[model samples]
Target: MPAALEESAKPVIIGRSSSHFTRVTRIFAAELHVDYSFRVVRDLMSSNPEDYGGNPALKIPSLQTPRGVWFGSLNVCRELWRRSSPRPRVVWPEDHDEPLLANAQELVLQAMSTEVSLIMGKLGGTGDSAHHTKMRQSLINMMAWLEDNATSVLAALPQPRDLSYLEVTLFCLVSHLEFRDVLPTAPYPELNKFCQQFAARASIGETTFGFDT
Candidate 1:
């Protein structure tokens, strides 16, 4: 059995609450029944050595585990999966074309996230205009392809009710996109529907959307 959630025993999550990456980790932790305490590390836009120490890339969702510090949301999730009883497996199918499709999904989601971040910066009056235009074009192109292709990709994958890292990452991306109002929600109706369904789950409900401090 996993250790109980003692005050001092909780793993420290070295990131702010509002970060989608951090939320993904938190939600996974909740699912795995891994107790954690979140520490607010603000000023993500600044390049500070201390901030980089936790996650050399200065990314959010770095975990301070008993073993040591683990970086990256996905990496932390994997660790949590390992620690959890009845370990979770990747939800994508093995026999079909799921591996490639999953890779494409992740790539598009990453691009979409970057675009939304740029758009947020622009709206906040702290972004470069040229970069914003370029990112917006890229986002639009990626979204078009995602909308046109997601159904086929999903069709190839096995249907499992339990959430996987892929689903968690995808959920965070879609929620962040909506929260930032980067794209019209109606355009990606299928993705939006998936998000709505996923959001109703206890883990997701516990990790509501917000911008990190």
Candidate 2:
């Protein structure tokens, strides 16, 4: 059993610490100085849908806030932002007009993350060549684009924001790639450096990587 949430204040974050999505929520909670109870759901192989009623998708990191239950990692983070007094300002420029770039970045992050997950799953038990090939090509393309454009793209971002959802999600994806040895780090030096700096954050440190039991 996990520790109970405080009655006076604080929200309950129910999820395993090992999930990347859950870690993102934990990092956000840590940044906001929000106390949360982490309900560990070890090994998805043994976890049932009933164990995650708060998130119908059966995803980890479902948050039970004072206002209501929040599903999805980013959704939970948004709720955390809302709950915080003098809410932490947006970490990315809200007025940016680079919709194409932003969308591309998000798509790449999602693709890379999905690739990592699929590959890891394959290594753990199942194996599929077509899936591996598709993920490999998608990741390769994304890395090529980032290697050729990351500096300029990042330079155009609004300063003082520190980080964005794109940045953090990308960072998590890249870190997972390395942690699982899914790909060689040499292919993405710039991304490697960005993740290194991002990982140095106190919030990130609190949510360091570990395999789910």
Candidate 3:
């Protein structure tokens, strides 16, 4: 390829706009100021890996780069940060040594995963199944815990940080619950307040959730 063509090339983010997991990476890309193209995964049910940017897990938000495809939201965000200049201060999961912060991160992710499972179950026509019922209860429990502790968990974080995975995931999870109509967020006042504050960022405005055709 010519130098111009090579310069024009950029990493591709494979995922849907409505997906919370994908939104997390998109927000990271925007905040990191890393330029990348968005490639929507049109069919979530597609068995072909190519539809998900060669992700064997058939998941979205994979990063397709010159080096290789990075799977999962965290991997893609790290890669995007690596490609950014004057990298911002990022707080990773390992930084949380205490149970409050650590467990908050755990439950945020667990709730997100549980939401995904519930959506997939609905699509799979496994409505009201035993596992699905249990997942719903688990999700509710996790959200309750998060709502009660969100303020303190956030307050306890180390100061002067550009971003943290926990915050991003929590924002996405809370916003997504409302977006997907999986649950009424009016009940989660603390989480809603956090979302309102987080939504003020430019990245959040740029990555509003919506289903893609």
Candidates in descending lDDT order? 3, 1, 2
Give lDDT tens digits, candidate 3, residues 89-122: 9888889999999999999888999999998899
Count of backbone clashes, every candidate in sequence: 1, 0, 0
Q: Name the lDDT of candidate 2.
A: 0.68
Best by the lDDT measure: 3
lDDT of 1 by residue, 1-213 (tens): 243433235577777666677888888988887777777787767577467335667666687766778887777877776677776545532233555576655665576468547765776896768877777777777766666766676565556635566567667777777676776668888878778887888898888877654
- At residue 145, candidate 3 shows an lDDT of 97
Q: How accurate locally, in lDDT, is each candidate? A: 0.69, 0.68, 0.91
Candidate 2 residue lDDT tens string, 97-142:
6874575466655665676467666857655677666777777777
Error of 2 at 94 (Å): 6.7
| Residue pairs in collision within model 3 | none
Best-performing candidate as measured by TM-score: 3
Q: What is the lDDT of candidate 1?
A: 0.69
